[model samples]
Target: MFTRRGFVKLLGGGFFGAMALGGYAFGVEPLARLSVARYVLTPSRWPSGLKLRIVALADIHACEPWMSTRRITSICERANALGGDVTVLLGDYAAGMNLVTRYVHSNEWSKALATLKAPLGVHAIMGNHDWWEDRTAQKNGGGETFGHRALAEAGIEVYSNRAVRLEKDGSGFWLAGLEDQLALLPGRKWKRASMGGLDDLDGTLAQVTDEAPVILLAHEPDIFPKVPPRVALTLSGHTHGGQVRFAGHSPVVPSRFGDRYAYGHIVEYDRNLIVSGGLGCSIAPIRFGVPPEIVVVDIG
Candidate 1:
């Protein structure tokens, strides 16, 4: 015979344990379904200059139970359908440091990513997970790392603290990307080392002129306030938009600024920031309120 209090305590513990196990199962299983959605962001600066269509995809933590080759290929097909002038992948391509080797060996996965096509081309940057997994030694023998080289081989330009100039008609704009700030943590050797200082935009923007607007692509939205004024627009996707958002409010967004830049479009000062909800799951794999997204920005 147990007291009421003791019975309640035992039931609560059991329920929590079941939830934890369920979460683990969700994370380690492959849910290879695809959904396509688009967003239109009109920047204030160039209101009627270039009609730039940008498709942004981020945080596809492809691992044991999250994503698969079929899913990636499906996403690529949808992106192509959007017919955006440029396709920007905001990082976290792999699940974690330990899963890098497994993904590299999966030829089907690599080929699926390689099949992603865009007229202007696809550009990407490294995320924390990418650095963590790629920079670690595999339990299985063989020296292989994940970073720009892998994406490059697949025809996706990896921009780590670098910028590329895109020209349309007679006008051109700058596209800049930074290495994951999380890589700077102690005891980790990032595959693509980031240039120190969050305020260090001059080095990345050296090639760009004041004539055209600058679009900055950083993996995490935490660097929003740090980005230079020269950048007219910034795109990020690390928070997963609280992945499991409530009906009217988002859960605790793990960032220094709380829910200030949790998800969706936000205007800060003169810079326009768009934080995508991302396409896949991680940590606790189940996404309740926040579904995956593919943001489409039509710059006119």
Candidate 2:
């Protein structure tokens, strides 16, 4: 009953739809949710009083289809399974200003995130995306007002640029966070109080006793060089390991330093920097070579 041209068009449309669905089912959908853990052991001259196993999850740009309640629950379940003493969320918990409103307006997301538990409790910092994107008011002026409140209610402390101390086994470490360097962009002036000065390593160290190991958490890996030598280890997750790496190369990274600040462990002088690939996508929703990561750092 159909014309030859119409029949061909129908067949072509069906074929394309099948291919699209197949691709998602076999490729993108599977990658939409994944968990990877990288382990590191830190040996220090100080007494090995605490075998602190901290799990770091960062950049969960939570949005529909890609980042959802199921995905978050999966991440939490996996982290709990790892049995980490402390869980640290590096930043960029929401996708962006617009998407966050679409998702985080209700309390469901926050309540789900609250389920994540750690013996030492969970600590967090704000990523550039959170400050620049999520906080931007749209035409409606309805921005992250509720989302920020939700995160706070969920018991996740959002450190703009501050430090908190954690004590265990008679020893303690300093955990400091800084405002996003991207705040350096035009129109968004980062408060001096929120942009902790890394130029004075000795000054920052003065705040904490040398006996306790210090761990600094910054959202971007570009801040690595600025960190003080006194910081035993620094955890970050902005680069996303070049979300779409290819053939031993990460072609796309958000850093100005390019591959120099790509991913993995980098040690310079006495400072150690661990750049996590992160657990979510940004800019582009597809990930090729880069895989989501959950980092575990064992400091003894």
Candidate 3:
């Protein structure tokens, strides 16, 4: 029932709409948006009277003009105001994409992060990018990377397949961190055809000598299925909510589980996982429906 002129107008409108959407995704969301995604849960088997507040920052991917040191300091200030019992850095602090004006060095970014304050102190774990981007560490087949050293010098504890027991008001719980799941990439120097990881889930959990409920920090949510019931909650951020979610789904997800572990609160078999959309771009500087976020988890 449309005339030729109307048809042409419809085509032109659609073209401009697509261009507008692309512009917003590329130029606006990833650069200017920061949101808070919060989750409050009483996980099965979590102790009744022990309440904990955890503030988490993940996938920083620091670079000039995108995630500058000034911006990171502002983010840290905001996190401190949240008054979490503990602060956790979920890694990927290095630049994740080539479309950057300049990469923010580890020292600059770590120094900015040093301003964060929490009662239980700040704990960290490395992400795949933290491992993959460190050429010397990759070549050495698991030695200290600049990322680890920078974070350590900044007074943050970087956990690598390790566990630590923390106490709050006469109650204690364990914080376990797993190594990056995609730590090793295939190359001639490595002499491997497939990607391998340094993550040690079972070994890390075995460090628990008592019946304290545990909270696990992993870079990627793909490990959720393998997480045992002993862990009251699991936190991760690598997927970035697919970085460009649309219609309640991301067209392309970096995870092996596709959109299954893409973002937000996921509970399976009484094991809870919260995946943050994160605070920087990866592969490309683009974001649409899913904006950058700082995740807060309150658990009992």
Top-down TM-score ranking: 3, 1, 2
Candidate 2 residue-wise lDDT at 59: 84
How many residue pairs clash per model?
Answer: 3, 0, 0
lDDT of 1 by residue, 1-300 (tens): 799999999999999998975664344322534445555666667736688889889887775435666677777788778888889999887774243324533345556777777778888877766655653522221133365567777777878678888888778888998777564434224333432222245677786756688899888888888777778789998888876677736767856787888888888886789898888776666665567778888877
- Among all candidates shown, the one with the greatest lDDT: 3
Tens-digit per-residue lDDT, 1-300, candidate 2: 799999999999999998886675435733564656566667454456677888898888777666777777788888777878888888787674242324533266567667778888887766666554544522223223344566788997755556678887777777776655554224333423332222233444556755677787788888777776667888889888887666756877888789877888888887888888888777756665666777877777
Clashing pairs in 1: 28-65, 29-65, 97-133
Question: Predictions ranked by lDDT, top down?
Answer: 3, 1, 2
lDDT of 1 at 222: 87
**Residues 1-300, candidate 3, lDDT per residue (tens digit)?**
899999999999999999999999988899888898889999987788899999999999999888999999999999999989999999899999999899999999999999999999999999989888998888987877788999999999999999999999999999999989888888838797877888999999999989989999999998899999999999999998999898888889888899999989998988899999999989999999999899999997
TM-scores of the candidates are: 0.79, 0.78, 0.98
Report how far off residue 118 is in candidate 2 (Å): 1.1
- As a TM-score, model 2 comes out at 0.78
